[model samples]
Target: MKNWAVISTWSMSYDGLLKASSMLQNGESAGDAVENLIKKVESYPLYKSVGYGGLPNEDGVVQMDAAFMNGDTLAQGSVAAIENVKHAVSVARKLSLNKTNSFLVGEGATKFAMQNGFEMTNMLTERAKTIWQNKVKEQFKTGLHPYDGHDTVGAVTLDQAESMSAATSTSGLFMKKDGRIGDSPLSGSGFYADSHIGAATATGLGEDIMKGCLSYEIVRRMAKGQSPQDACDTALYPFCEDLKQRYGQVGEISLIALNRKGEWGVATNVEFPFCVANEKQKAQILMANPGKNQKTQIEPISQSWLDDYQKQINAPVE
Candidate 1:
């Protein structure tokens, strides 16, 4: 079995996964490795769904949600509807060390980050503002439901010491209501970890993701002797089907898991791209989609896909 592993939702996390892999290979703590990995994504301006350039709310404000979990202790820290913080994941990581009031929101969360010396910046960029403005105009003119495909960067890491950590960060859905928050900052919904068992995280419609507490379910199954892959497929596929039956519809849902042995698994109801690395493998991007019989089809991401994505994210907003 591999000695360490790191897996994260979305192809956008490829670079971060590489860095985190290097940290894990060098014997760094899983918590530090995962946090720094997310920090890389949070600082990238081209990723419109995460920290620096994340899309804004309906009122033109960039509100972010983030969470961090220490598998060794089950300690979790979270922030929601926070604004202006350069790395919302960092704020959440700091809160993980607290015993009370670890979950903070709105102005209170922002204040805690400020008081704790976190970097402060205008999280909304000109490009993001332009896109949000155009989206608003389009929705107003078209009178259609707002296009809502937001991707969160959720990661699970296992270190050489067998310690595990999970974290999630996102600016939330574009044109979201003011003070609105999603599953990213909510433990069990967005992320969960346990050193003795495994770690898992989810990305997609947080509202639906929370309805089933998908992440926690995956880890719970792993603790009961399920492989990471089995846990992810069994936990996610059944929930997706049940949600569709009960709720009449389901949103895009994707999940990633890594067990203490450095094995990994993924399941998704959409064409999801993710990044992963382990002691026996270099960091690489892969694609996952729901397949026949409720299994997930996994394959290497194509260069053509990467090229197109790069162009799309970097394209100028009209």
Candidate 2:
């Protein structure tokens, strides 16, 4: 019998993985398992970078993005900059299962969600609103808002039938420019799954991951016979290399992968906490290293940068 397993991008994803594990145990489809897992994360209020309590845009509107891919068919769907919907991953799954539409954005996405019977509720919570208000008052001067540390959430599943699926969801950056769609809803950048090869998903700075098509690169490497761990390491090397060349340090960049044989791995430029679970293993948080002897070059937001921004935020109103 093929082993069943699930892995996700962050520690918070442990909850989702637990849900996925239950579904897998009950014989759910791999696609369904992953979609349900991401949907759970989207509804979590504490993880402000995802669905319900996600950070707001420059206009204080919460816009979320999500994508889902089925490895067996190489089919996928995505929604971007969607507003008021609580489970963007479900909408993305609907699109992926749709024969005609592979992607929808902005008003179109919201309209589709409404048409599909998804309740249109204000996704921004009181806590998120208060934070947004403070951010606007400070003109985002600190660049150190409460939501800055939360990254996109993602999941990859390998089921007993050997099918694979990957899903990703996020609210994008905190106080981002209006209409800014990140890598989460974009194919290859946020998530990729291929039954013939494996599956891969990414989390961290969306712009850099999108430019590199990081998740796709990882799966492609696996297709070339690289192990799950090697594929993750190989895909992350250039991202770290580019950052080192430009800023002499890397920022956060993380990936999780599952090979065709059900072996899984994770790699990150910085210390990224993630989780893994399976039929035989319980979900547990683990730190993903860049690779063996791979020197970490991740530079934290500098104290000077934070200090300057703090001063600007504290400046007396004229």
Candidate 3:
């Protein structure tokens, strides 16, 4: 019997994995296991990069994107720039099951969510509002800041039935342009799954991943007989090389992959922590090594930076 396993992009995803473990033990489908995990992550209010409390766009409106892929059928569903829904990943799952529309975006996605009985709620919390306000003030002086480290949350599962499934969800970059869509909802960019080979998901710097279709490339390499680790390493090489040569530092790009044989791997341009869980093993954080030829460490804007920025925002509105 194949050992059932689930993995995700960040440490917080451990909560989701725990829940999915129960479903897998109950003989649930791999797609259901992955989608359930994503839904749980989307509902968490603390993670500011995804679902509720996610950072807003320039207009201070929270929009989310998500994708779901079923490996056995190679069916995909995605939603982009969707607002008011806390569980955007569920909407993506619904779309995949529908099989009529593989993709939906912007107003269309919102409409579909409402028609399909999704709850509409203010996704922006007071904390997110404060961050958005600070970002707007900062952008007025300098152009948009460089990409920060926190990013999309994702999950991939290998089930006892020997199938793979992957899902990803995110509120795109903070203070981004209105209607901007990231790689999260774009198949092959955010995630790819093939039951015969493996599944992969990506996070961070959507633009770079979209350019290379990085997730799909990883799964393809796995199909070519490369181990999950080798595929992840190979797929990240070009991006790492380009960033080092052009900017002298590796920008953010992290990936997680699981092969049909139940082996898993991860690679990143910077140090990233992920979670891995199986029926026989409790979930654990895996600190991934940085990519080859990585030059400089990329740090998130510090607390001091935010404190100073907040002071500027509060300076008597001058």
lDDT scores in order: 0.93, 0.82, 0.82
- Name model 1 segments beyond 4 Å from true: none
RMSD of each: 1.1, 6.3, 5.4
TM-score of 1: 0.98
How many residue pairs clash in all the candidates, one count each? 0, 0, 0
lDDT of 1 by residue, 47-84 (tens): 98999999999999999999999999999999999999
Query: Candidate 2 on 42-142: residue-level lDDT in tens?
Result: 88776678988788897999999899999999889999999999799998998998788779999999999999998788999887888788888776586
Model 2 ranges off by over 4 Å: 140-150, 246-250, 295-318
Which candidate ranks first by lDDT, i.e. highest? 1
Clashes of 2: 0
Residue 283 Cα positional deviation in candidate 1, in Å, after optimal superposition:
1.1
In model 3, how large is the Cα lDDT of residue 281?
69
For model 2, state the Cα shift of residue 289 in Å.
3.7
